[model samples]
Target: MNINGDYHVHTAFCPHGSNDKIEAYIEQAITKGLTELSFTEHAPLPKSFSDPTPDKDSAMKWADLDQYIQTIEKVKKDYQSQLKINLGFELDYIEGYESAITSFLNDYGSVIDDSILSVHMLKTNMDDYVCVDFSVEEFARIIQLFGSVEAVYDRYYQTLEKAIVADLGPYKPNRIGHLTLIHKYQRKYAVDQGYQFTIERLLDIMKKNKLELDVNTAGLYKEECLELYPPQAIVDLASQKGIPLKPGSDSHTAKTIARGFNKLSLLTNN
Candidate 1:
């Protein structure tokens, strides 16, 4: 694989990630022969966004946004000659909060060079937002409430559709992160059928909006999901539909930089 960049990565600013310095990831990317790296720390949510059990340690606080941008901007200049660094955020798309999210992007989007829009949380039957990627136990519990894995998949894709069409002004993300992130626990709760219609609709939206797909490899490392996100079949379909694809390690730790890139190469080769 002739990988040139990694567009999804986190720093110590993300509480869920390791407390490694931003420089540590840059050093690792350089060692791995990557010329570009984007620090897409998870964007912070507003207080009004309901979280029954808030994972305060997951994302950076809204107050830290300034420091986070300053840190990346300074390092970007410092590494200009050695590597290309981009300032971006991994924006989470939650229903009923589009206005707040859009306002945030409108305020900072001009300064951002890249971004990965993702769906990490979904409204449950209980009408509260819960993380879909937190843990297998949580996933299992949520699926039971929905009655089946297929119901969960349906809702996930529907939410993704809304995310793709969302107008975050001109700075809306150009890339969709982990198209099948709902399958993070595939080994435990496999759906009987692939949501082909939903996937096709999403592809059409991306094609029309000129958005790209994050060929995320983090799932391969997860014991529950032994394949790359969105599955190989979806990748093939996206390739056929002319949807652009970018490799994202989704690295939360330094050691995970560019992990499972060989699998990404295989997708392109075919």
Candidate 2:
């Protein structure tokens, strides 16, 4: 047995979730006979929607996250016989969002065992979009000015570079979530073929900084990649550097947990 561990599990603390109470999920994992259970709730963000003029509501759901942690602590004792539970959070990054990322991270980082840096929507104009690192108006303005297909790619890749390189913390990351899944949306060029332009730099950056990425297999569930990010070449390079590895399904639902991890493991082990 692989000692089945699920580290990317989320809970109702995120706006995108419901009924994901850590205790309930932990119990479910025990039912499934899981060996190790971890809860990595979404990282906290600032209140952009509470500007009063535009009461769009916050991008993420509101909850007593600290209390949620305390609740997990309370429940852990009950599940001690079935599974070992750990705590973590999935952090998002934007250039300006650094302060919020840093603030919340500093407050909570020490308390948790690990954190992951995931760049969600690539900051769009929609205030509701998790990708609010940059203004959507700016993305449109560039499109209108340049009007070249390559220009859009240039901007997107540049933005991604910033996100990947952003100053995170004392620990680089336990595992990287969907590395290039962003291409499923905005990528103009074939990600694998054209990724060199992006990877050539990011590879060196991750290597120099000693960062390792994940082999996220959830893409099989979403029908995106044959698997998820960092492509084969990147995986090879990371292996060469002796960078660490973490296999994840990025499971949102209990059913999606480690869904395609078997095939994903074979691909990355090369």
Model 1, 179-253: lDDT tens per residue? 989988988888899677888888999999988889888988889898888777888888888788888999999
Return the TM-score for candidate 2, rounded to 2 decimals.
0.74
**Model 1 clashing residue pairs (backbone):** none
Task: Tell me the lDDT of model 1 at 18.
Answer: 92
lDDT of each: 0.86, 0.58
**RMSD of candidate 2 to true structure, Å:** 5.2
Instruction: Give the winner by lDDT.
Output: 1
Q: For candidate 2, write residues 67-185 as lDDT tens digits.
A: 76786677678778888877777766554666666667767777787556676543443432333213344334544544543555555566656766777565445455556655443
